[model samples]
Target: MASNKNQHFVPRCYLKPFTIKGEGAAINVYNLDRRRLITNAPVKNQCSRDYFYGQDDQLEKAIQSLEQWYGSVISEIIEPGYKLQLEHQYTLKIFWLFQYLRTEGACRRSAEMFEDMIEPTGLDSDFSMSIKEAVQTAMRAFAENMEVVSDLKVCLVRNATSVPFLVSDDPAVLTNRWQLEDKRTRGGSLGLRDAGAILLLPLSPTIFCLGYDPDVYRVPSDSGWLTLRNATDVEALNEFQVLNCRANLFVGSLDYAEGLHRFVDEFIHHRPAARHIVNFAIFEGEETAEHKKYRVVSKSDFKDAHDGIMHAQTISQIPSQWPSFLLRRNKSCAYYNGTGIGYLRQMHAAMIETARPFFKVSPYK
Candidate 1:
């Protein structure tokens, strides 16, 4: 059973890429709340909990198997001048999906949602689920999310500037350009199948990756990879770690700690004090079962993040050089001739029904 007492939600192998020499023993950390940079923070004790996923050997085994494969793949990815491969992309995408769902921040967010649901039900009579339960439930849905992500196009980004990339406690953060532009709709959050959805994760200090809604955004690329030459783009991207990180922001090296700290200090205000913002509305003229009806929606409060205070609302707003494109709009009809798409949603059970089974490929290979 591997004595799985200390289980890492954010796999140690994953964080090693952003560590000193990819050593995994130590890394630099920027504590947002504490307003300080912690050099050489022990990687072992950073984002883990004892039995975080509960005392289940099968679950831990399944996670370790994927983590092992992911580590092997990371070696190939961080190699200098390594060409992007479909096999590698597919493998990396799965790793990102697992990382997105398997963090303490993710579990905490799920627990919040669960607790909030119970509060509304008024069945507050000791009905509860732990963060461990939330993580297990998230694991069960990994296959479903994988299918949802398959609709998006993937790309690799190579950082060309001296400003090194940074990571976070929750690395695989999801953002929707369309929704984030103007959050006027009742849609509380962005889903994998949602139009304009983008997933960003920093693989190494130099290599970055993203999966985006192909119909809405066009990332200017050569073949399958793009080089990030502008420091502004790097800064904008790094701000994501600041805005989305649960607590600690990690870097591979402290060489740019001063620069990174200055950038974070200027923009950390974009990160909200709370994880969610609740919006409520009351309607009086409803002719249904009651004269008065109440509607409330809780959304992840981020900087452009939140309903306001945006560092970069869209990718166009971020990168100055080698900019990404939001599909051109034909003023008469946006969605016509495959130009602009107002919104896209995928919910058919068959379209995303957990194909290929979970952990089908043996990690032993």
Candidate 2:
């Protein structure tokens, strides 16, 4: 019989090692929950887009390294009749499947670019079809494994306009409200508006994490929590009402720092009888200097008004050449009243892969 570690299925290796100019490359494994696993050694000498385009050798090497690391981490479940065998394998399979799907997309894009450069008229439909078939096969295998595991559902709430609301028992009302709000807010898009609060309520004892685009709402207020309404007051109120159900709210924004401030205040001070709230602030990495300076000034004003206010710029480290002022107001939120700070640096590659094809970069292009 295979050892427990051997029985442990490692997801297809999707991670790649790419180096920056001065910095070396490293293989990164980011789980569904956004937790990061960095390789022991930073793979060096691999840089440039050309490096990612070559043969399958580098990809094969990465897959081997990932399998080794994964086995080392999960070698303990070797019992002959482990009850959770299906569940464990299902989880790992899905995680790796998503990673592989994303890598496949990257690979296809790289191939397309190369073909375009070489022949001017890109690869034929047959090649595209082949890539799609491979991705579909990997996705199917992962999903089939999931059938043995119980399905878990999560309720998402957005665009709440008011301070207090209740979860409606009706699903139709909830659906309609969510749709209307989505249209009004352009999909509950992230950007700063005003101050608001996000309440997290868990229906089961499951671990919860959240991610959001900060450009969707305005900057939250520094006062922690407030009950204010903007143009979409009704939609926001309705969103909060729906969210009061089995849901946890993740809040952030770039426009309204005061809005975020009020959210923290309400979350910490009110201490709703629900699951703990996890706060995160997302920043666009490609913002201009003037825009970034404006954001810093605005965030500083908000931070100054509140105690224990923490901020993080982008989920990862900022470039050293960037101004020091950009670093100010960039620490994780230290306040704890059943609330914790989660600094998520990278976007979910799996989610990105699933959504990117449907989204065209240029409406006309």
Candidate 3:
């Protein structure tokens, strides 16, 4: 862990409600870092001039309104099993609302006036409906034109303070951690370590760090933040690549499985000679009895199965013929799809590297 004494700045995600008591209520949508203004709106006031007098005022008001509504809606709808804590739900809702509002803007009609706008001709209840329709149409056009932004890759770098440590390498650790003991027990099959490897990968121009948990066959716990870099900083890139190359393990999440898969298929499919170790933590779809059955696959089994390759970590390992392998585990794979590609590429590299040395040399000569 980085020095807690120095206190790394964690971005704050919030939905701040702004109300002058009787004057009006609005919400300010803020990202975790509070760097960008998302949207704002007035709850009771409807006059365009009374609310959004200028672009700045309009934006601020819209952000405030969005934050207010998001907090209310999430608190009302989210269920216990969804794996979204109240705070995370707030972030997700803020992201969704920001996307929604950037295209549609604020509803022209008052909240109570919504009934008057709906009609049998499929017309919406307000002018905002038209705005939404137009946004959707534009989005479809962009998607067809291959202009939609699918992922946002971020790079995070932290000076290693202390090497990673694992508590136990006993088979009982896996059985207890994943509740797999009653089903299968392999003798002396557990491996624990005080220090593990960290791999870094470049997504666009940024580098992301990856690692493994030797105790549980799971994804490495991420450092929780990312650093933006200048694309031309070759020195920084070289340093990042060196740190990544020396990493002993690779960790990944199937937070955005589709995007991750696309990146992997594109990048790794052509690199036939690269040996990589990949691990994936799959999070989507409903779990079934089959997934519950074979949960005891050990780290060694994972290492052996992937031919000792590990990189990307997902809930389930994707079967492939790309001369790559995966270490699989189950976890809440929630992540923004915008950064999935870089993560997948890193995993691909790890898997390929893990399998490279074992390929039998041809004796044709």
Candidate 4:
């Protein structure tokens, strides 16, 4: 794929070296829930995007590295056109997928081995080859061509409202693309057509991790989980957009919804010592001589929030979805979930092939 050498999109091959420990099945990295190795999750030797997201410490390290890589790119390397935002809501969505995977079964590590630090040799060559192949396939599946941001340091300013009554911005917009407010709020749309209001906020400039399910709604935890089953339900959601920012959106899963709620629940609402770090201008009307622009003060002043966000504005929720239409429909949609047995089996075979070149113990082989 075409990628700027300066830009640091997480590539699969780059992550393969981290998946395996010392050569051999004894020290292999396996999933706790499935009791199997992730290398065996791909289909017909095809590594899926979920393979990377299914990892725990490794995936976290990838994200942290990507974030840092992006920071350096925007600062010292070539800058792209799109903007990035790192609000609490945005960071959590990216983090929530791995958080769920860690819970579902990403953390079963193999026993420690001194040989882990040694380079692959002899029979271990085949095992190492499998790790490399699986990672390469998965990276190919997840690859995307993202544009370099023009203003690399530009951060999306939220709560640009002219009214003070709507000053309390809901941080839920960080995880779920939409934010549910009292329908009676003054900043955006305020319609009584439904139980409350739904505000499809502006496209977040920053990118976040994709959740398990793409087509799902984050209903109130008390409502026992809700989904827009048909066109009517989808229309209902569309019609409720008071402050319509954009129709295109990426939906979050229950993990995202609940995690966001927990974050809001424990958030320190009042930060007295917080200084005015960023100012967002809210216009009462279109920019004209008579229209008045209100200033909304924010505590966040992130200069490099554009690092890990999607390159496209709103074609899809997941960044990898931008590659091709065919890729978009594939079962491996989200990067932060797991693929089926096919991918794992393919990855496992690759490792076995790697081991065939030289003779080794059965377990290691």
The lDDT for every candidate, in the order shown, is 0.69, 0.26, 0.25, 0.23
**Candidate 3 TM-score, C-alpha based:** 0.18
lDDT of 2 by residue, 250-328 (tens): 2111223344334433333332242222222334344675543122324324334322222321111111121111111
Pairwise lDDT winner, candidates 1 and 3: 1
All candidates: TM-score: 0.79, 0.19, 0.18, 0.17
Clashes of 2: 44
Better of 3 and 4 by lDDT: 3
Residues 249-354 of candidate 4: C-alpha lDDT, one tens digit per residue: 1111122333323322332232212111122233334456754544332213112222111111111111111101001112221111121111111112233333
lDDT value for model 2: 0.26
- Top-TM-score candidate index: 1
**Order of quality (TM-score):** 1, 2, 3, 4
Q: Which candidate is the best by lDDT?
A: 1
Q: Residue-wise lDDT of candidate 3 within 126-211, one digit each (tens)?
A: 54344334433433443343211112121133222121111000000111122112122111122111111112222111122222
- Scanning candidate 2 in windows of ten residues, the lowest lDDT window is 202-211
Model 1: pairs clashing at backbone N, Cα or C within 3 Å: 302-305, 302-306, 304-310
Worst 10 residues of 1 by lDDT: 310-319
Could you give the candidate ranking by lDDT, starting with the highest? Answer: 1, 2, 3, 4
- Where does model 2 exceed 4 Å of error? 1-55, 67-100, 103-128, 132-181, 184-365
